[model samples]
Target: MRRSGCGSARVRPVLAVAVSVLVAGALVGAGPAGAADPPDRVDNPYAGARVYVNPEWADRAAAEPGGHVVAGQPTAVWLDRIAAIEGTDEAMGLREHLDAAVAQRAELVQLTIYNLPARDCGRRAPQGELSIEEIVRYRAEFIDPIVEILAAPRYASLRIVAFVEPNSLANLVVNTGSRYTATPACEAVLARGTYLYGIGYALARLGAVPGVYPYLDISHHGELGWPDNSGPMTALLLQAATTAGSTVANVHGFVANTANYSVLREEYFRADDVVNGQPVHLSKWVDWNPFVDEVPYARHMRELLAGRGFSPEASVLVDTSRNGWGGPARPTGPATRHDLNQYVDSSRIDRRALVGNWCNQAGSGLGQRPATEPEPGIDAYVWVKPPGGSDGASGQPGLGQPYEPMCDPYYNPPRGSPYPTGALPGAPPFGEWFPAHFRQLLANAWPPL
Candidate 1:
């Protein structure tokens, strides 16, 4: 969705400083709260299931987002709560400020590391995706440090996830807009097979932290089809990466999965509209958003992985700051023209549309789901995108900016509601649809998560 609607409540710097002091006291083992219950360990979807939650952005200041979403709380006080972040949007380099912020918060973080060299993934899309010929050079230029991080002692546990190309190699294939498939010779090979191999190669050469692994957010740059070729895609990517270096048959897993099952519901405008399928099915992507059909997808993904003797953990982080909540409050017809880029700011490229690879929307409320089933492993559902970061022209280009001013604070419903159960002043209904639509129009733009 485009980054518009439901503006935020700014978190003043003074309050942020105060909170930092309080949080720092706790970390040093002297807070009145007394250690915060060891951080609430839950059932491990992958035995050590850990969900990564990136801070809003270094520029926004944790204090601001904290004061916004966590309102009344100083971000400084919650610095230790940070887990991971999407370091950059372009195929350039990591944002040092964002990196520092993540490193400061979570002991580990995932930097949208890439394998594209002599070619850009996002910025330079038509460069033939990522060529095998460039793999070595790509690794030399981009992957060296990830390996070091896994081996580094001071930050041995400090980790990063190499989500090769904001779009997986699958995006390289013709047609399907990078949506996965198990058919066709080339598509299957590039996605279901080679991709993972490349990841493993990076891991072997770069070394993933013992507790960490390289994961594929395959849908980062494209839409997904049913019976997602996720299993095969994962296998191939890891196989390619590992085979490139390791003999251990090291398997790379998926960190995020797509659940883009949306219903095209319509609001009643006139009785004639329904007769002609006016309001209903008019919008195409109505009630459904990324997590709309997630559980089913997860189940399928789990079955596929487990069948291959792999137990993987997936992370469900929401890009909440600006996704339009409230479902399809209005109705649209088949030609209704859904706009995923509604919040995009044409004036500036800083639009926060969920266009391609970003998946933390408000409607996907899996965070509140209790850890019941474990067959298809899932550790935790977290708020990946902090609320209040302007969609476009809001933050730094590569390092996306936070929803400025403040976070639109409100309670997200407990569970199983079209929207989160609790009330959130949250952005408008389906406001995020615009940017995604905008990106889709661009031949090079990727799809929303």
Candidate 2:
């Protein structure tokens, strides 16, 4: 339910160095250890911890051919709707998942706290069950129940990494503007301050619990990679961090590329490279964004957030669930062509038709396997968005999700330069596991499973 756009590339040099220093601090566990000072808290929640593996998702994955390869790996349990809080006939409730984690001897459990009022304003489908005026109910029903379940003494030993509201704050940054890509729904959300209230309330309540680390979602490089977008987004997030009796301490860090297909790094090209006497950032694909991929984008954003008063211990997490563009089509090296477009097209690993394509992309693969502190400044490489789950429906009947044009492989936008949606066809509604997509992900996994 995220959309994409371009931004200016103007990150200061000092901030870049700050990223390295912060990463060094994280490596040595050096810092005030603000919220992490609690007996149950640690600088990195995933360090020396076994993340929870959802039995429901594991059963689905194991049912597929060759699924055992990844079935044992951990994935986040999403509380996307109210029904999900209390176990549905087909799914486990929040407490059930936590109990299962205890049984599995998992030290860490990842939970995605989605379902803000008027959620996913940038997209037509998968709208939240709450309305704009239902913010009170969102807190009373959604956030309250989750907090109560998590506060149970039996679950206190578990290090809970709660991914707070993916696609919520970032939409307030780019989607509320007057640009052609802007939607009326996002404008209303911005005007009403719905996202800030919902996210702030969730963070305050969740962070109050010991051992709970709240990582706010900041979208990804493809969405907020530019100075114009990133600057505004940093400001908005700061505001959200402090809203509704919440402070910067309420936030542990931020997560990027949640459920979106953006490569972890671009091996062949840099954002400022000049090819054919033209800046790579100016190319159609790069679109002038300073960050060529999620790593730099996330590190730079952490720097910005720290400068804005977040704790120095605040690190970053990347959702490497998808975005590994591997398989036979994966590029080995830089393109020899002098033309800028050709060079970018051939070298980039993200095979989407456009960076804005956020649906069930066709050529994407399982990215880096979930790991602890895989990169400097990254708290963890996580599977926040479970691989093989549908981003949304592609005009499939009997699927409850509405048809979003971006999910239609044949539907091209009228305003922007026309490009394929790159969405795989016959997909089910959002969050349902798709067998074909799972098989493709397995076949193209970067580390070869």
Candidate 3:
């Protein structure tokens, strides 16, 4: 989930030229062999789904011994290069990748666009290279070329499942109050005005790309499960669509739990009200508490959006990449430790601290593989976040960096520290292979490696 850092002052000149060249090349790249007229979208563009296998990820998996289990796993390519100097490189790479897909006659590709200004809400690692004042440049230099590539007739036959800006809107919901959420970056954008408009611009551009299905990122249940946040969250989404100069119909759907580790379900069974030893309802879990997982979250969110004029075709895709808790459940009674791992009820166990925990979490496993089997209002359960890449620093703080809450030597009690443990320390930067996390994931894979 790292936002690639900004360019140093000395490298700005070089980066400027590189970006220009990248955009030029993408707009003029030779059309694919046997390119035909752009494909039309009379029905759902993604209805015929075949997930793309990212060549870069596959190559990495094959070379890393610990990545054997993930070697052939279909992972995604991120557009995190947005606003960074490397954006040009990523754009060029995407054109090349699309060409390769055309050559292979592949049907789908998972592409995540993550470089929004004030990304990660001014979080710990991978602070983006760009600033709020630079968002104009973001759209002009980064998104424009991306749209050109996707709209090109050469790629119209390929379905691009574009996961848009993972944490931008979610951060707005969870961090509106700067002091409480510890997100000064988000506050800065809100105070300056036009933050929502920025989102609108991205969506509008993406909406024009015929073969691209844009799924706006919404934070998971852990952060927005309360009834209080639901209305505001829904309103924020509506604003996003309105400001984008687009309607809900322009978007294919929304994506939840992107790169976050909230499991698909707790060990609850009954579907009627009073299920899970909680209140009785269609969703089976009471809304106010942290009990709502992704399934119920998507169901409720979609219904709310539909009420606001979104197309019924607007759906959801949850990232089931790391929620598989293959380990034994926590003790059903009292916990011997005060950390957040207390057994909340007979059937539910609290795993990570909250939805905000994005680091390499302990005891998490690989979830069900990418699939199109419909689940309630969910369009599909896909692994948008590639497995094996480190979430962030896990070991000792790198080079004079102080210890952070997310990394290893994990704070005691796990909920915000106060206790201690013997767990491994922090990990490498984002996108780099974390051998320890990779092994743990494979070993704990739900169906077993």
**What TM-score fits each model?**
0.48, 0.90, 0.80
Show where candidate 2 strays beyond 4 Å: 2-39, 396-401
Show the lowest summed lDDT stretch of 10 residues, model 2: 3-12
Which is the leading candidate under TM-score? 2
Selected candidate, larger lDDT, 1 vs 3: 3
- Per residue, candidate 1 scores C-alpha lDDT tens digits across 252-286 of 44433322212111122211233222342132222
Error of 3 at 211 (Å): 0.8
By lDDT, the candidates rank as 2, 3, 1
What is every candidate's alpha-carbon RMSD to the true fold?
A: 13.1, 9.3, 8.0
State the lDDT of candidate 3 residue by residue for 88-181, as single tens digits. Answer: 5323366766775665445666788777676666555655545777788778877787888788877877777778777777677667773365
Q: Candidate 2 residues 1-449, lDDT tens each?
A: 53211111223234322222222111123222222233456788878676677776666666678876676677788888888888766677888788776666566788998889988873556657888889999999999999998888777777889999988888888777766667888899999989998899999999999979999888898889988888999999998888998998989889999888899999999998999889999999888888889998899888888899997779689988788989988999999868899999999998887898888889889999888788788878888888878877778435555778877777885554478788899877777777888889998888777
Candidates 1 and 3 compared: the better one by TM-score is: 3
Ranking by TM-score: 2, 3, 1
10 residues in a row with least lDDT, candidate 1: 76-85
For model 3 the TM-score comes to: 0.80
After superposition, the stretches of candidate 1 with alpha carbons farther than 4 Å from their true spots are: 1-67, 70-106, 118-133, 157-166, 172-197, 206-208, 218-222, 228-235, 246-252, 257-292, 312-324, 327-377, 383-449
In candidate 3, position 386 carries an lDDT of 76
